[model samples]
Target: MRWWWQPRKQHGRIGRQVTALVVTTAVLLAGTWVGASRIPTRWFGPAHPASAQAALPVDRVVWAWAGAVTTTSATVVAEAVRPARRARLVLTADQAGVARSTAAVPVGGDGIVRLRATGLRPDTAYRYVVEVDAIADHARGDGRFRTMPSGPASFTVAVGSCARTGSSGAVFDAIRAVEPLLYVSAGDLHYGNPARDDVTVFGDLYRQTLTSPAQAALYRSVPVAYVWDDHDYGPNDADAAAPTRPAARAAYSAYVPHYPQPEPGGAVYQAFTIGRVRFVLTDNRSERTGTSLLGARQLAWLQRELVTAARGHAVVVWVNPDPWIAAPAGGADDWGGYPQERRVLADTIAAARIDNLVMISGDAHMVALDDGSHSGYSGAGYPGFPVLQAGALDRPGSVKGGPYSHGTFPGGGQFGTITITDSATSRVGVELTGRTWRSTILVSYRTTFPAPSTPPKPGTG
Candidate 1:
């Protein structure tokens, strides 16, 4: 809200020339620069010292996750030490005061509170404070999130996977620093013993992983979309036979704020649209079989969603937990193990000619990138889209890209960032940055999406 210009103490000819060059450069890329200027003020907050009251019982209000955010509605998932009697959410356009309040939201006995706040303005920035049972403001959890624009817009998203429970890593802090509009965990949010089917164990794992100061801060600030894989799915390469499958799905419903599952009581496969991009977050572990990765029903839904989105949106992003490329060391955990299903998906996309499609994958332990040449596509030489694999926030070990891998980020512990810039000219620019937990760039990919023709006006066709 405050702006100031500093006067140069002394500017010689050389200084004046440099300043002129800077201004000229800014003018040259003014269209791209326009997107940066629209970023919300104070979208990200600085780290603050915990107040004394924060350490008291009121501190039971631990972390909050924003989910299923559309233009006018958002779901907030808050965690407490004990089942909260009364939970409230105060929303404000500015961080200072409340514009509206959703008071007395019901909290379940599981210490998980889900609150939906509606009637928000589209593409607007809001800061929320969650208070449990008349807790003081200083002790409440506060963070900021922006509703997706109903019209053309530009935004950034950060993603990673395979984070172990009770762990901290630089990747968490780095993700927060990037200040994305949204964050997603492709799968394996926590590694709990897959053999256990107890709801308490799954709940405890989420608490231990998300309540960590660094990870909590990131989730609190940016809205998140979630999809689960093997570990979080209840075992190593768990499938339909996993004993805890039902409990796993139930716990996810109790905690994460996600779009409706493709099927009523099936794996957490859902699709959502934000601006000109549509995202398909798949559940690859559950209902898994030698015949298909998502089973028949979910696969049908995915095909329908992709075809629909391709006709309407400028870009489509598919979130696959397992790598689309051949498995490393002939491992059965990735798409290589489900060759039939992988081919079906690849062929479907190619046949439909879905333009501007980008696939993001997790659960691979190391960051890797590949063009569609190795994406299991058949009936043609290769598909044109790119696949980005990122994760292993706390694990150790790295592998190089094989015959199918184009850019392999060696070493362990990394995250992925996708930045999209929408221009007035109807062109969208995308940049993917793969970085280590320490913020070192390992590989980068860039592409552009030309504007699709607008749909026919209503009652005209």
Candidate 2:
């Protein structure tokens, strides 16, 4: 008599549907437990005041000639209730405010401050000051940086990623030692999950590195540009489906503001040209749609940018969070996950016949040089472009997924420096170094790109 006991023509179908629903619910619950349990206990805990005299860890410096912007971001740890508010960031060029400013307010529990100084002269050295606002209960420090020359610029820009904030000191020291004109933090700036100290290990590790003598000396002398990857964004192999994506986005927002970026979510992936080289920065995260990695809009934007760059005699550098050729099968974390988008990008570049298309990325914990030929992907069709995967400045020894385990660095941390010399004959050189070891062990091809035949007027585009 009851519905449960009633038999009908569709009774079997209804029973199967109900069974499927129950199974799905159970599976979802199990997944939730797995995800929740994975979250480290340290992340949700309280904060502690760091040392007032603590040092600041500097990472990458970026120089943009076309926009007339030389930007730098540093990771600083100070002993205070509020490190961000207490810290002061200032940049001075020839005793002028070429680019000098203070750290933002309400420094988080991590004590990491992203500092940026903008509006500077081309090919010029500028002094910077970081101070603590005693009245504001803040700690501070000082540093210096140099901007790239306008035309036919001869400058060095260091590139690296996968730094854990633990051994970042060596990388900073290396950069300072080189005294590069600017630095480009390709991606994976932080280990991600700033709240989870153990899993990400950014807060403590960054604190240690910031206090390092070698690292402090460098922050006092260089500028930096930054981007985020899965580790730095929130969780390993994270994406739009991440349940805590909002929190991750918030953290990213906080982290990015410390640097001199155009605008948050306003294409963190942007294009900047220095000398004859044009950099096409891509934001694989943020604005990502569905399971696709780069999303439709970003892919379209990238295609347009690539086309524009190809039209001129400029070296086109494509910066992504993950290596394109490393994970050809789509790891849901790299370009492989978005096969359609990646194909579209590769196809577009190939179609354009962009000769100087160089791929720069981070995420793999070791230094690697791939000819852009991952399994499953047709490298033959893509014209055999070169993809250089810079090792992490930190977390060098950690294992990475995919068939490329052999390339992983055995050491704990590492970084790569890219130097470009633009002249009648433009040349680009890459130097892979160990942060803790302090040695330039690995080197890449020194290739020449087409030199710019005409110079464009400089101004904010």
Candidate 3:
């Protein structure tokens, strides 16, 4: 099962089948010309064992990505290969600081071990190693993650999604080259869409993805903020009703080093901050119902978070893993499918005067940016915000979400980046660029945002 690509008529050309093996050898092969991007082979090809991590030994640790990063604290999640007696995380600041280790949290029945390192400096770079007594293959145990800045700062965030399940394409390498402060996996991190029966399926799939030398290296290099779309949560176009919902949520909580999930054992929605910007990540799949994209309670929380974030931060970034702008015949799988909800959100933003908002959405399989032109779906064009659509990491490309201000480029091996610079001036700098597997810029847009007129709210949020 690959990403949520439908029939040719439903998503023309998106059904172009390319098995993982076929992709690994050709289109995804390192140092090979990616047929989609039509670019030269510049990326460091597949890392060690790019095609075969499925047989990973049980003794080997599988920690996908370092996440839930904050100024003074961070979370590191590790999955033991099997029965383990001990698990811990050793952390050391990159700038020559005393080494520290977190006390081992009990490994869950699913072999999940979570560790949180605290008292770290803001925006500081640090190296960490996952120590698991049950795992013998811990050669790649060491990785790095940077803490978010506490105040105004300049940083870049790379966003990508819609890959060929566990593709180790050059796109991941390209994203790493930029050395982003964080990587926002917008969704479709994998297309397994495994049956709803077992939670271990997700664990193994994550192991495959995290062990893939390429993707693993990228995650180790950068902290990640991820939200799942249909393909990852369940089958194509899966919703809250999916039987796999429980298993998916369980796997996510146990395996992912994500921000503190607001609903804990429920929906996987979360919010985080970087410098003066606040990022709101919505669980587009878990809480989604037939009538609402983000169920009622989640929707209400999102509205409050948005208004609060907008008031406190200089900028608010909505990390929605579904297409916000509607496409022609963009039926149910996207925000286009829930017009009323869109109106509610738009109205909420307008009523609260949340003008410093910019949205980064995914599951489009294409790179498109709307410069606050056609993204407004509210009554009388009340609330408008710039939107950047990115992804199809290594899957068959298909355009959804519509006529972009900078036009759309559809194909695999794609990603997007957002760089925010806070200067002494009153306006903050926000730049969005869509790049390809070869790091080729397809479209770039820059917009200056006003610094918050009000004082920083800090914990008032």
TM-score of each: 0.82, 0.67, 0.86
Q: What is the Cα-based lDDT of residue 339 in candidate 2?
A: 73
Q: Model 3, range 1-461, lDDT digits (tens) per residue?
A: 11121111122222232222223444334554433322222222221112222323334576546888888888777766667767788888989787888876677777777878888888799988777763324455677898887778899999998866556667788889999999999998988887675688888888778876668778878888888998888999998899899899988877888887768888988888888899899999888887788998899999999999998788899999988878524356888788888888988888887789999988987778889888877676774788988876876556776657777766667889999999746899999998877677877899888887764543213
User: Candidate 2 on 1-461: residue-level lDDT in tens?
Assistant: 10111111112211111111012365455653422321111122101111123343332211111112432222322333343344545555785546546545554455444444445567666665444453422122544555555566656666677654433234455556666665677766655344342323443433443444444454445555566676665566656554545555444444332232344534356666665566667666655655567666776777887787766635667777676763545355566666777677766776777666777777765555544344224333756455666655644233333333113332323456556665555444432233323555543545566664566333222
Q: Mind sharing the TM-score for model 3?
A: 0.86
Candidate 1 local Cα displacement, residue 100, angstroms: 0.5
Weakest lDDT window of 10 consecutive positions for candidate 3: 1-10
Report the C-alpha lDDT of model 1 over 422-442, residue by residue, as the tens digit.
Answer: 764567787877776556776
Model 2 off-target regions past 4 Å?
1-68, 71-119, 130-140, 192-216, 247-267, 288-290, 330-332, 371-382, 396-410, 425-436, 456-461
Q: Quick one: best TM-score, which candidate?
A: 3
Candidate 2 deviation (Cα RMSD): 14.8
lDDT over C-alpha atoms for residue 340 of model 1: 66
The candidate with the higher lDDT, 1 or 2, is 1
Q: Please estimate how well model 1 matches the true structure, expressed as its whole-model Cα lDDT.
A: 0.70
lDDT of 3 at 434: 87
Q: lDDT per prediction?
A: 0.70, 0.50, 0.76
